[model samples]
Target: MSYGDEHRYGESARADDELFGGSGQTRTRLPDRAGDPYGGARRGGRSSSRSLVTVVGVVVLLIAAIAFANRGGDGSSSADDRGGEPAGAATAATGKRPVTTKTGGIPSGFTHDAQGAQSAAANYAVALGSTNMFKKDTRHSLLDLLYTPAAATRLRGPMDQAYSAEFLGKVGLDSNGDPPTGSTFVSRVVPVGTTVQQYGDSTAKVAVWYMGLIGMSGERSTDPVTSTWKTWTFTLQWTGGDWKIAADSQQDGPAPVPGDDRAATSDEISKAIDEYGGFTYAR
Candidate 1:
């Protein structure tokens, strides 16, 4: 459940020292195992035992070689190790200030670059899939903040019509898009990872893979609780020192085969959703 003491950046001073033999000498050893029955055998038996030892030694060496190769060269750093900066300045910015500014209670102010595009994509997926979008006022505000100026006005009316009173009722919400008195509404989005497909000085294309929760909870509920995998792709532009989405689209994807886990009771799902708060994501 825990990711251990390793930092998110993948840079551990202890790991580095261990890999390079910080004490100025590398340890060496011969391959041998105790309690071998062939230790004191006949001449032919001794030869066979030597062969076995040789095989074991080779296996050990191969494993060590593979480990070293996988770790990359000692001079290289991983993507996470380079910190969330534009690709060129990434390594030098490793210990730079964290990006944690908020706009209208939503996290924003990402640097204008690949890392910034990734962070924006992840957060935008959450906002777009949120339950608040079902309400008229909140939906408009969220769209205006997230989309480019041209797209915002164009999408607003269509989105409002899509989440109309009739649509809300079909989804188990009242005319006002609220759950019944004894029931609970649950909609949440969780980001899995981000990828930048294209990058430039002023624009970037990023995709976020995410799982979302939608549906209502009650004895008479339909569409009880389900998980969906969606890829949200964003075209982002640098404007006023921050990365902002220009256009975005969603597509179903890369979903795993469903598990056989038993479905939770409606009430349980409702209670859990109500009790838990969502996260503010960053890449």
Candidate 2:
């Protein structure tokens, strides 16, 4: 199985038309948050200790009020220090800094909130779809930084199996995961937008809509580099002061109609990838 097949886990196969060319978009509804519905009743008791209990309750309430006030109305001030504004549309940037640190070349230290989750998901999409993911060392580093501990362990084996020697040959990569001397392999993911489908204090479901470029670039290349649009949904957990991927899935097209612009040549594409660098994506 290909990495696309294995990594997508239980998702059904998408059609070529849906994957490569399509109009409009499809939004997946996230699972609703379940609530605890059975709180046991407290037993009634009358004793001289009642007065002391009431005094402690008042002190606790005062402390909570001070904490809320310190947060400036909503409890998320720490994450959205600039104040969270409505995004208006599904694809708007939140106009806030998403992360401030890097670990093993992947972005780290995401704020503990929804915008932070969106940011982490977008950056991870770029990393996962990049040519670097074909190499074992860099791939392992990325996996460890971006995914939750359990998910990283579970996926490492299957993902290694999926990106096999045969698959490398098919994609024009050498056994060591390098492109031919005269050729350039492209596998960059550009995130166009992000949406928080569901959010909580400690978890978030975010989707990144992105365009990915893949294939080989050279005069003798049979599989010329091509682009595909996809929406990648990630389930994130607040762990170790950052958002980590708990799970993820992908679906095809919310793609727009192709433009009438002329296609660039193989040399031009290769030159561009080499000259241009990717951005630190934020939402």
Candidate 3:
């Protein structure tokens, strides 16, 4: 797969670490008397002001009347047809089934719909971001299983060079991509949600919003586990009766506000990561 920490696109996410913050837009407020609550201009000509107020008042009154008429009706289900989800809703799992089959330990047999593309992208993100990608053998197996045959062949050498021994050492992994004794290497991606950017019968583009945990866990480890928020975009092709990753990219962001809780200890973090298994994330 064209997904990994060493990929330039993935590296770009870390460079954007300082950019994480609230996503709220900064509202531009006009001078107190310049604007009115009903979007009326305070200093306009009398004739123009009257005309605007008349129009706005009528519109507002109509809207109020409509709302009153439907006040007690079944408006709850209308949320499903709201075009896009509300702010902060896209980061939540949709509770749909993930996949129907697996091959070589990677999810397969996704449905032939937008939801399928989303599920494939989410699962592929998890596989690509796993610690297994640091080792040659596992990486090869994953590529063979999840990527198109041609893409896998073309990417094998570059991926091998990307996961070089020197790179492994910098991340607290030994030459064989293993953490030292009594230490557990953590490199997992938990997809919070997925979206279909573009979809068709044969090809699709899906983006997976995920939180990744990486670093080494141990009493003596200098690099403690940390989390990062990212969005992984996969270009998938329906080939051989499955969705295969043709190429992929990643970007940082859509990060939420950090919580006020205290940081967990190494043992606590390791235990949580171990006990809490990953999910087959849906749309």
Candidate 4:
């Protein structure tokens, strides 16, 4: 399988670990998909793997309302990690409610403060990174539910173009986004943590670092499921009454070193996916 990343969605640039984006335009996104709240690491806006063996977090680009980026990452990473502490060690959740209700099976009715923005961005990451994004109906439903009206409107055309039939086939799905007869496809995002870069009364910028799983999970599968880490940033506005994404972007990952544990079998992975239900993320 071939792996490639592009810069078509007005690509972003990083300087000394600084993360920045173009206007509110979303880059092309077509991967297996999401559930859970936070999962990946922060890096560059590398594209999802283009063919078989693809594994990446959801990459959503916005056209006009993007804000936030990593401001500092200088000094030696080895030196920083020498203490054996976790990243974002200073981040702690507020006792405030992260969610209040669910609309269309997705978390909604978030508070208007920074915590609410964090909660919304985290949940939206799961929705955007899920397999549901591959289907026309569900995709549109998510767009309507997760994004601002104008942003969703601007996204429909490009998003459709990105999740083209050709792209779907490449990811082992049919035109309707279904997998093969005896195979099960898996795509999910689990957020690791979130940070607020810029927050105001009506607009807040939050970033989610998460881990994602995507691919075919079946015995005969040539491309068994794999994992990828990424950082997702969102520019959200307190719309109507809740926080809605105005624009967003993704980066590769500051992935941790792999462990030496043995890999699981296809059946094990598939069964696990089926048995482990997703949670309504509020982190």
Q: Give per-model TM-scores.
A: 0.70, 0.71, 0.70, 0.70
| Pairs of residues at least 3 apart in sequence or in different chains that clash in candidate 3 | none
lDDT for residue 183 in candidate 2, whole number 0-100: 94
lDDT of each: 0.63, 0.71, 0.70, 0.68
Q: Tens digits of per-residue lDDT for model 3 on 121-220?
A: 8888898888888898998999899888987887788787888898888888888999888888888998866655555578766667778888888999
Worst 10 residues of 3 by lDDT: 73-82
**Candidate 2 lDDT, tens digit per residue, 105-137?**
777788786667778888988888888788888
RMSD value for candidate 2: 17.6
Instruction: Please identify model 3 stretches exceeding 4 Å from their true place.
Output: 1-5, 9-95
Is 1 or 2 the stronger prediction by lDDT?
2
Minimum summed lDDT over a 10-residue window in model 1 is located at: 1-10
**Total clashes for model 4:** 24
Candidate 4: which stretches are off by over 4 Å? 1-89
Q: On residues 1-283, what C-alpha lDDT tens digit does candidate 4 reach at each position?
A: 1111221221211221233322112123254455644555644445433421243222323212222222223211111222222233233344456776899999889876666777888888888888897798998999899888987887777777777889888788999999998788988888877766666678766777889888898767877898888878787879899998777777777588999989999888989988998776554
Which TM-score value belongs to model 2? 0.71
